[model samples]
Target: MKKAKLLAALGICGLILGACGAEDDSKYDTSTTEVSESEAVVKEPGLDELDPAVSEELSKMGTDEEIDWEKINFNKRQYKEYIESLDEQETDSSETGESTLTVVSSSMVDDNTIEIVINNTDASEMSELTNGFFAIMMDTFSRQLYLNSDYSDGTNQPTIIIKDNAGTVISEETDFIEMEETE
Candidate 1:
């Protein structure tokens, strides 16, 4: 699935970026925006204004019955600005190439849990590699949720489940990854 590939690629890139250290963000200064009390309060853009694809995905972020729409909708302006800020950065995909760990599907199973199914690849120590990817992926994924002021649950870190190609969950929990022993 293209979505799976894109998410895996993003996770890989996120790992690379973490090792590379934080980039200089001084160019985008917010000090100038010192609106006085007399200035009218401006209304920010809603989720409707975001890229349809992203908006749709974020709209379905939380629970099915009582989705995170309320929280996400309240911060549509924040997400819009966040996405726009990301677009400002330039990245070359050719440098990263392809990721060895293929993600079958990364789904949000609950408000505080993310289930990621990764296909078994030729990489040695598959479990070890999967654990590493899980940490990186969870950390990266949590940032988006943690960005929302209203999202306060599960130690402020969503639990991540990693599964093998056969759709068997091999790892569960977060921060500290615990693998399920197989026969």
Candidate 2:
């Protein structure tokens, strides 16, 4: 269940990032020099190697301010592995205590968009479940792509709407938080 939630959060973040657009400022060649079948020379530019205009445009695209772009892995294999690790973080469920969150359901609407229904086990709204489990979620979902509008302040209903690349809402979930009092 935890893994499912984390994957959903990551999908949400990726979708949000995909929605941001940045104009290309540089026309640098990306072709590789073939030395051999297994040893082609690739031009992997680091963040510092990018033109100032290009860097500025990327920064504006909601890239995390905390990310050290210089240290990013340019290798496709390594990058994919790093992303997998992020989604598979180890958590001691027994030591973590009871989860206040109850994942009602989740589904992917497209390649990028996903919607998750979260229930606050201890409170009527998720705004009240902003403690233990909330912290865990926030920590795990600390992607810069998360917009302020993605969350509720307890004053309104909780809804998750993930959009496609064309800015069309692919997944829309309403009433994720139950508001009824149990007898």
Candidate 3:
């Protein structure tokens, strides 16, 4: 029950920030700056690496925008409070040998990275939260950071990893690594 609530709260925050930060068609930047052929384009963290579908959805969730300090602080507070509440929940905690999700830590790894660690849970279990699984899971956390963090400098890599309660990484899931150009 606590695990479900934690996911729900995180999802709600994602939804709220997504809605608040989204850019509609009317807000398109009309200014054009020409770049020379020799100029190298600096890629935003994890942008080119993401699956096309995930990239599109992340853009829709809102990126390349000004910092929303008020919203960021608000969400941070909410996240902290929710995390604090997890410990207060009752736990029989007897190792019936069944794995249970005990801790969920969500935070920015840097201005360029957002990391979400699910303790005592398998990465595959995350699919249970959505109808369609891995892509949605990847999109959700990436979008959450894109919409909520101080990711203004074209730097933001999002990672989702699962670990056992013993603090060992069980899996480093998601195709967030940059791909080679096949063409």
Candidate 4:
């Protein structure tokens, strides 16, 4: 009976030692790993490549205007932050994901009704929050421009149109224009 108990204890010890010494499959074995030289390097598309249409539109607007492109570009970061701040207001799962923001065009229609279209797409998931964010961003952008220039000096206020990737109009606000003073 003592011999049987000793053998059982030895078996348990063997099991414990085996389990403890067992190789971990979770850890990657770099020593035996072979990397192929033919592996393709994926490159992200640059801003110019992402939206050629928008670039074309901007180019057509002409550079004769006094607008500060540097300030406008810098303001884009704030616009992004403003959108992120509104995430808590998002109750839909479809609205949460990576997104790309692009200003399609800014056109002054007869020096009164200026139209600005901003195109955005959720990189992963689609949500109402995406649209909501764009709306707020457009408002912010308009406000920034209006505060800096006489574009709102005439009877017409600017109208902004926000669109998504599928050419679907997400949001449009005509009242966003700041009325001009009658001097």
Instruction: Give the candidate number with the greatest TM-score.
Output: 1
Model 4, CA-based lDDT? 0.50
- The count of residue-pair clashes in candidate 2 stands at 0
* Backbone collisions counted per model: 0, 0, 0, 3
Candidate 2 C-alpha lDDT tens digits along 1-183: 999999999999988876653245245445855468567666555334645643454364335455443332223222223223332433222345554444333443332333443444343354343433433342233221121112323344433443322344433444332335989
lDDT of 1 by residue, 42-96 (tens): 6776544754644655656333643343344324345434433432332212235
Q: Where in model 4 is the C-alpha error above 4 Å? A: 1-98, 123-126, 154-156, 176-183
The residue pairs that clash in candidate 1, if any, are none
Candidate with maximal lDDT:
1
- Residue 45, model 3: lDDT of 41
Worst 10 residues of 1 by lDDT: 86-95
Local distance difference test scores for all models:
0.54, 0.39, 0.45, 0.50
Colliding residue pairs in candidate 4: 94-126, 94-127, 95-127
8-121 per-residue lDDT for model 4 (tens digits): 999999999989867785685558566676775545443334244434433543255444433332123333332333323332233445455555554444433434455555
For every candidate structure, what is the RMSD over all alpha carbons to the true structure, in angstroms? Answer: 23.2, 21.9, 22.4, 18.0
